[model samples]
Target: MNTDRKPALRLENIVKTFPGVRALDDVSFEVFPGEVHALMGENGAGKSTLMKVLGGIHQPDEGRIFVEEAEAVMTTPLHAKARGVMFIHQELSLAEELSVAENVYLGELPRKSLGRVDWATLYANTDEILKRLKVGFTARTRVGDLSIANQQMVEIARALTVDAKVVIFDEPTASLTDAEKVVLFEVIAGLQAEGVGIVYISHRMEEIFKITDRISVLRDGEYRGTLVTSETNEDEITQMMIGRSLDLSRRTARGEVGKTALRVEGLSCGSLFQDISFDVRQGEVVGFYGLVGAGRTEIAETLFGLRTPSAGKIFLKDEELRIHSPIEAIRHGISLVPESRKEQGLVLGMNCRDNITLPQVSDLVAGPFVSDGAEVAIFDQYRDRLEIKTPSWRSAVGNLSGGNQQKIVIGKWLAMRPDVLIVDEPTRGIDVGSKSEIHNLLRDLAGRGYAVIVISSEMPEVLHVSDRIVAMYQGRVMRIFDAEEVTEDSLIQAISGIENGKVA
Candidate 1:
């Protein structure tokens, strides 16, 4: 809005290269003071790389970075923060055992006489920031005790601790509830009012359109173009980010519905979820839809033997089974691609081949040691089958993009040849192009007669990929609807614990 003002932060012709890849290539971007500039791209489009350059995590091979119209060299993260650049990363960098005050002023805590921490000053300052943000928790509260949303508030409060001219939010709302997101938007608005520039990175188009003033796109490490949010549309932005318009239509019914492959009757995991009942037939994809903390992931965990059901009956092919561990679940022909791939699904330090074959490593072993040939064969099979884009089988899973990493997780589970496959938030942080691919892959899996259960917070994803959707609210099933008959309004109402305008 302030066209005459100098940019709060600017990157000119930035180029960053890694082994076998140019992560960023001649990409230029600028964020004006008080502007919410959205950096849009598919998963591997170099947005993260560019942000790293700005955060001084990785130095750019070539480019100039200007802060407030002056060229500055950000040699380290400390230097970047000293230069008024702050990053609120997706995976929070807070020490859980520390209090909110301590986490906020982590590295630069105020000191009193004799090098002791000035506790009173720290708590007072943090309380003021918390009050300004209108957050519920106090500065004295331990960060580990707070919800994910409140923890993020601590991160935002940390940004305000310094004279931050620019704040970078990387997928800030990925784990937030709807009410939490509203509060976050309010905080962002307040920051804008204070003339602080924001660089927002997210895959959710709706959030981008709603909150951003300007949108700059990147495609395959190259700068595409920038557009004023008010003047552009999602289709145009999608084209700019992916080089093609996406098919936003729902998936048609694929594969004949057969006998029930998995059936859960009266499933209960204490207060996490209650009396949950569902059945996934052979060659069908059943989507579980809800907001965060609605027990979607908990239900998946329960099904995968990560949690014991207080009261429930699990049946595979109409045969009752007691599964007490993940290995037991796998032995019963059930595989779970967990919500957090980095934490639960794959070993980041391990190569792609090892990650894929890990679940079935025992079976792949020879007389004494593990067989590399067996592992590579399984990896190659799934790599080609899943179309994972890795440099090689030897490439570490951590080096791949979000979409590819997700595919590898799926590959890991798929190698077990499970009768029932549950993928939780299958395309959470992936870009539009990869999202489409994952959606299709789920359907294709169903077509191949592997019963699929998709647990998603994304409404469109559930509607697009599911044959039948189970909407949950506060750990209870609100309603079940055939995808063909489900309306957005109805689904929203169901997830909100309302049916036909009354509380469900």
Candidate 2:
């Protein structure tokens, strides 16, 4: 609304499609010079599709793009760059083996008159760019050795190398810690000061409120609305994004703690965790809350037989059990939906249907060959149950977005019909609607008498879904609160060891 400011880029009536799905339809928005405009939407809500169109990764079937009020055609990434548009992808794309300086100046490296690589000029120039962004890592260091946060900083530095005027960042803070997020905010502010128009995309509400000046929402491949960040609350934006008021209130009145389904006595995995103990009963959801390295995941891995407990006993239904591998755990009706969905949960090369039936494919098969009809029928049930958004079961699992891939993982585990289901970060990188569906699915599992163990860093999720919460600190069971006694404030005090600090 500032008359003094000129618009840097504008997208008018963009339309794009692939196969049977129209990924983007008549979407329009504008980015002003030196301002942060956020693109907010559900996973398949046309946000990614619009960005790809802008970056020339995909040409729009219909629409117009303008730069500085002049019509422009961007048919390739280089063309977009020529108009001063740079895009940082959500998936980290730095060459791990290359040095930070080398990556910063990768394609457009400074060269001598004889056409030789100018290492000295590259390092000197990259160092200045890194310093301007306040990145502490040495430019000469290999990017693979740096943390995820630092690696992202290197990617941003590469953008500066291009002399980019309009920068688009997708899910920039998805992996950053709280301290790292602060550093990123400072960097973004610095870029804005330099008159770079920035388009930021993320699902974290607090982040959008903090870093964005204007917010745009897209739903089902169409532009929903745009709002000024100063006048909006999370509920208002969420309503526009999801097209309804969200019942985020998740405190359930659990009937009673039924018979014990899982019992771990004196569980230990050497130095990872020592003398851990817990009990999970039927129709109960128990949450494990901890920091990154507090050994919460290690405990889940041990229980699922990914790691062997140095000394402990696991009992299911009052019968002692021995779990030496994931297969054995599955056979004993214990399943794990691991944290890293791509690396551990689903096979990217396979289709959604195959990924769902991977665990118990043999059971669905007849003779020595897999029954194609039986496989399709079995997968269709889960695909429908999980509300997976795919044109067909034949769609490659890798092609689906993060939330859809997560549903496939959940479908795979649910097909196993496990007595105890352990899920780690169930809603990470997913949208509000998908998150609600997943939560309902977990509750349904618990209602059907399955013992569910959820591990999450989001306090709202833990407090909402769990019948009883277990707070893990320094690899020990620091505190446990029943459903009736747990509140957001109390849970924070228990997990952080700070009772008087501000939680709300």
Quality of model 2 by C-alpha lDDT: 0.86
Error of 2 at 428 (Å): 1.2
- Model 1's alpha-carbon lDDT is 0.91
Candidate with best lDDT: 1
TM-score of candidate 1 against the unseen true structure: 0.97
> 1-504, model 2: which lDDT tens digit per residue?
352676889999999998888899898999987889999998889888898889978999999998888888899987888888888888788999999998887777889989998889899998998887777787799999998778888877877876677899988877776666787888789888888889999988878999899999999899999899999998898888888878779675885567999999888888888788889999999999876666889999998999998998999889998989999999999999998798789889999889998888888768889888987987899888878888789989998978889989988998888999999999888877778778888888898898999999788888788998888766777678898887777776766755456421
lDDT of 1 at 228: 97
When superposed on Cα atoms, how far off is each prediction in RMSD?
1.4, 2.7
TM-score of every candidate relative to the true structure: 0.97, 0.93
Error of 2 at 317 (Å): 2.7
Query: What is the per-residue lDDT of model 1 for residues 1-504, given as tens digits with 9 covering 90 to 100?
Result: 696899999999999999878989999999999999999999989998899899989999999999999998988988999999998888788999999999999988999999999999999999999888888889899999998778877887888888889999999888776887888899899889989999999999999999999999999999999999999998999999888888788754555989999998999999999999989999999999987778999988888889999998999999999999998999999999998888888899999999998878888779899999999989899989999998799999998999999999999898889999999999988888899899989989999999999999888898899999999999999999897788899999999899778996
